[model samples]
Target: MSSFDYNSSMIKAAFFDLDETLINAEHAHKAATEKAFAVFGYDYSEERKKSPNHISMGKRVYDNLKARRDGAGISEEQMPMDKLLDIREGYFLSFMKDEIVLLEGAREILEVMKRKHIITAIVSSGTKKYVELVMDIFKLRNDIHFIITGDDVERGKPDPECYLKAYDQALNELKDLHNQECIVFEDTESGITAGKKAGMRVVYIPTSTSVPPINYLPDYTIGSLLSFKTEVLI
Candidate 1:
């Protein structure tokens, strides 16, 4: 929930982080990775996902996973990168198709944002295909303004490339938009850091699975988007 002053601000655009911010991406990613590995008779491990923590992802899921797994010294279980990607993405979409669930108050807040006409977009380190699939599953294909996936950026979160690109896109979509007039909602430290580096205020809403590292703070932190009124910007 949010409570603040109003009537003296300019917040024209709002950017969101997809995974763990709006939807249950952690669960879906885990499910997909598990299925992808099982398809090749390998097991998914937490160590398999640790190598790319600080880097932004700009590759397809297979390449992304391959690199990380190789870096982790577990590349022996790999299959063709393209095939791995197809399998991962297929299972991911299929797994999430029936189980995709929005965070508390997610739709309500989006509806409010829509009614007010504030330009909204998704700035995520996730792949374009996967993000689109998740949006489709959640029935949010047209609910937001746009989505800037890792595929759209040369660099990813913590590098500011994705969020900065998102900011530029939002500006293009909304004339007279300023950096300060944009706010980012994120659930991870890297995402919050990226938003700040992009010169936009950030709201941190931590998810159960991806907790923010200690001391990683944002302009604001709310339990849910429900009480976050647009007027609070003023």
Candidate 2:
């Protein structure tokens, strides 16, 4: 029931993380990984169910493929980085088509933010294409003010680059607003860390399962986006 007054002219923008925060796409990631594994004739269902710390699933898959190629004595000339990227992109697209789903209150929360005229943007560790797919699925492309994806930054979440990029984008979009006026909504530990590191007030929304322990507690924590209210906007 905690609330904050947002009527003050100071607060202006709200930054959000996509996966697990604004959109429930972890399931999609797993499905994508499984499909990607299938392309290599490897089944990952057993590992997928038991593992909760596979944040860099795409990179992991790429590394696995690289290791296999090396073991087979494939020349470096044969396995170019572009080819690897293409394979990952193909698998991710397949996963998006088959398994992406938005979290239950995402549309409502976003609508409320828009009604309030709060500048909103998505800052996610996911690739640009994957994030866009989810946004399209949720019909949230136009609703969001901006987006900062993995491809936009040199470092991903937990490093502050993504949030910084989003903050910069928001500042450009909401030119009248100051940096301190922005806030962030996140679910994963890395996402929260990134937001906090960027000096924005953060609200944590834990997922139903696989809630990672946050090293730095967020300004606030909620069980779901459904619990977010205007009172907490400050």
Candidate 3:
């Protein structure tokens, strides 16, 4: 983690990315994709997943599988996107009870934010169902003031649309809050880019699934949320 400091007192709102950022679900996602492919007598490899052609994370299961089909020369008629998504969702749900878990310091930070009366929201590209599931498992619904899911936005991350929407809502909730007074916590290149583009300070926390070699840098980078201290902001 860097020694960079934050003016926490000035930060009235906080936005967080889901998935690898809040919970350990990346591997479960990978496993679900692989299992879905196997059902159709296809294989998904690490090399292909790491390739530039791989679809970006945080996209709908349908979009990700569609990209995979396109790359594999499989037509939509041969392997329906909806069917693939259904299979993937089933596997993903099965893993949720055991494979997926809250990351270290996740609860502590949320508690700190709540205790300090800071507005907290989840700005994620995940669907409402999945996001709600995570909130239910971790019992975070009360801590989060609002949620902006992929369903709420026409565009996904790396595009500022989602974060911009969140910024607008945050501004509405807090009378004097500005974009700069909002901080975003992210674990992926796309998420970090979205936050910066939305004019919010970003805290980048790398995860196992985070794609590297990003063209841009975040305002702050930390190894994990465990290293984050809200006291500095006070």
TM-score of 3: 0.88
The regions of model 2 sitting more than 4 angstroms off are: 1-10, 46-85, 232-234
Model 2 lDDT tens row, 1-234? 235446544557888877777765566556655565455555556444333443542232344344444544444675564565576678667767566667777888888888888888887766777778777776887789888877787766678877777777777766766656778888767677777888887888876654564586687677788877666443
Provide the lowest-lDDT 10-residue window in model 2: 52-61
Query: Which portions of model 3 miss their true places by more than 4 Å?
Result: 5-9, 46-50, 53-55, 58-60, 231-234
Quote the RMSD, in angstroms, for model 2.
Answer: 4.6
The better candidate by TM-score, 2 or 3, is 3
1 or 3: which has the higher TM-score? 3
Candidate 1 per-residue lDDT, tens place, 1-234, comes to 333435536677889887667877566667887888778776777656656553323233544576666665665545666677778888777777666678887887777778878888877777887788777777886678899987887765677888788777887777778888888988777778788888888888866645454544687778776757667442
Across residues 64-170, which tens digit of lDDT does each residue of candidate 3 receive?
A: 56767776777778778889878888888887777788999899899999998888999988778888999998999999999998888887877888888988887
Q: How much is the lDDT of residue 92 in candidate 1?
A: 77
Give the backbone clash total of model 3.
1
CA lDDT, every model vs. true structure: 0.72, 0.68, 0.79
- Model 1: residues >4 Å from true position, as ranges? 1-8, 46-68, 76-81, 214-216
Cα RMSD (angstroms) for every candidate in the order listed: 3.5, 4.6, 2.5
**lDDT score for residue 176 of model 2:** 67
Worst 10 residues of 1 by lDDT: 54-63
Scored against the true structure, residue 118 in model 2 reaches a CA lDDT of 84
